[model samples]
Target: MVAGDRILMHLQGRSALVVGGTSGVGEATAERLVAEGCTVVITGRDVVKGRAAAQRIGAVFCRADVRDVDAMIAAVDTAADLGAMGVLVHCAGVGHAARTIGRDCAYSSAHSLDDFRETIDINLVGTFNAVRLAASAIARTDPDELGQRGAIVLTSSLAAMVGQTGQAAYAASKAGQLGLLLPLARDLSSKGIRVNAVVPGGMDTAIYGPEGPSEALRRAVSDAAIFPKRMGRPAEFASLVVELLRNDYINASAVELAAGTVQLPR
Candidate 1:
């Protein structure tokens, strides 16, 4: 078959599990997957919002926390039951902002260890949880004529490379995901499962809150972009995610979605 034909066949009738699909980039990705003719199951911790988002996008909702092993396995099983499990997109993560030292310069004013651990557990460990469980299901699926069984796309952040002040925990966790990409792709190669990551920068999403980010804050971030001079849209993020999952040769790659912007310390 021609390469174009192979790419077109990858999504149709396939089953995809998208972690953090209740909102933001994950919701957008799930919607795009459905439009591409894939059966998608989205997972989130909130039952109401999860169900609502699933309904809005014509996807199935599974209430599951990214950090929970059993919960993620159940989500994978749910997707597998929908069709041949072939896609896993992990978009779940938390952002934290706390400096290593407080302005008071007191020893007691150090960054909260609990907060750092929670961020790492949810962002880094949760990514592994989703990838490992989903890969197992995808590996079981019969490989295609091109020896491709499935694809996995992980959502990372440019902060991993250029974190601002007070973003140590968030940056470290996202960096961990990037660290996992290559080894994960290698380990899953024999099973015909590809792993890749998207490093987005300053996307306009709910992470900024329902009312959106303050004008000053938004302008500060947008000003750093080399061109377009605006934050990225979730749909733009979704587009890259779909491409990564469809393009079989993009394994282990970390594509930055920043508009030529290199974040600097505040």
Candidate 2:
């Protein structure tokens, strides 16, 4: 697609909802939507980040936690009140990594049960929950000239395919998103809606642990001699998402932005 080509969706006069748009790829995509003429609403748990992102992108901000069904529903309702939603971008996700056997999984010993379950709740179930709610609103909107009312672009990690030594919970959560796309595609086809996902490999995002690499995690990522050059930039991930949301043909699937680093285990 050339720069001269009109953006596939042309988003002008339409509304879009971007969850987790407070930072990284989500924030960037939201800005692009506004530039292309869409009224955008971005949600996140961070009020400061969310407000800053919205202000920067010329869009509105609605604080939300994807795991909170009520919060997501409110955000969706806000978007609908603004206008018919032309796009739904779910870029909200969090990462977790721990050697499965070593980490304390038991809540019985006064250890927190929050870690593993929270990852799944926020990254996997949250995506699923928000998509259905967004679809409900999108379905209400009449189709555009091409019979497309909206498209949903979800975020998953390369870990979805690459089950490293760690990331047991994170990988499982992300993979769930991939599993949902095809079925979601079929389910939403008649409603003029589409679902898809972006899988990013090792990124330069601040999600990196403060203490740096865990011994086991390091070996796992480097074991295949992949990503040896360096981690990928956040912008690289953002661009593909923009393309997917633009093209109506792209739906109910996932595109990996990882640099061929994640070879599926045989």
Candidate 3:
């Protein structure tokens, strides 16, 4: 049976919001949430893709950029309007590949400061923005019998812990997410909300490009895995996400979904 076939007891009739749900891991997670009986709202910057994804998964589409405060707030409001907001999965982020100093080692060949800033803004700052706003909406809802109000799951990358060459910006941004998980969970403890993160490695997603990763690149990354020797499926990642949301005991933690792969090739 697929993830959608199982309706999680805790999530039934609850509402959820998935940022960057137009495709990839976000889309997969949103689909699973619908299966678990959530009133789901998905947000993306592209209207056409966002609408199509939402329609495909039985979710509402909201066009919102993660970096924009007004847009994120509007997206949260849209989810809250459907029902009590109980789950938030932030999957919106970008990867950058530029060495601090180019191979030429010339001043003109240095990495662009603007690129680094953009990655941090969207991946790190945007995460905090969405979490804060969505947590507020969730806190407003009455807690469950267990005194649990809601749960949040953030998508962090394996690069955060073991960054490969040209991954400085991406790694730092994801690491920043780890920095937020524990503190945010602590801050929301009184409100009965939990925060956690999924650190995925080499997932099969569109981040590779429209054509996907080349065979050589795929094998290189897959070889890094300890078992099954392949990149992770988006559905597999989605499963962990729902599990984290369902298991109340698991909080303020970062779970790695890398098949025991701890290091990345340079």
What's the TM-score of every candidate structure?
0.97, 0.84, 0.96
| Candidate 1 weakest ten by summed lDDT | 1-10
lDDT of each: 0.92, 0.80, 0.91
Candidate 3 structure quality by residue, lDDT tens digits, 1-266: 44444333289999999998889999999999999999999999989999999999999999999988898899999999999999999999988898889888999899899999999999999999999999999999998777788999999999998999989899999999999999999999999999999999988888888887778877877788899898889899899999999987899999999998767647
lDDT of candidate 2 over 105-133, digit per residue (tens) = 55463323578789889988999999999
Ten residues in sequence with the least summed lDDT for candidate 2: 103-112
State the displacement of the C-alpha of residue 64, model 3, in Å, after optimal TM-score superposition: 0.6
TM-score of 2: 0.84
**All-Cα superposition RMSD per candidate:** 1.4, 4.4, 3.8
By lDDT, rank the candidates, best first: 1, 3, 2
Q: In angstroms, how far off is 255's CA in candidate 3?
A: 0.3
* Better candidate number, 1 or 2, judged by lDDT: 1
Candidate 1 residue-wise lDDT, 1-266, digit = tens? 67556653379999999999999999999999999999999999999999999989999999999888888989999999999999999999888899999999998899999999999999999999899999999999999988899999999999999999999999999999999999999999999999999999998888877877778878987889998889888899999999999886788999999899879796
lDDT of 2: 0.80
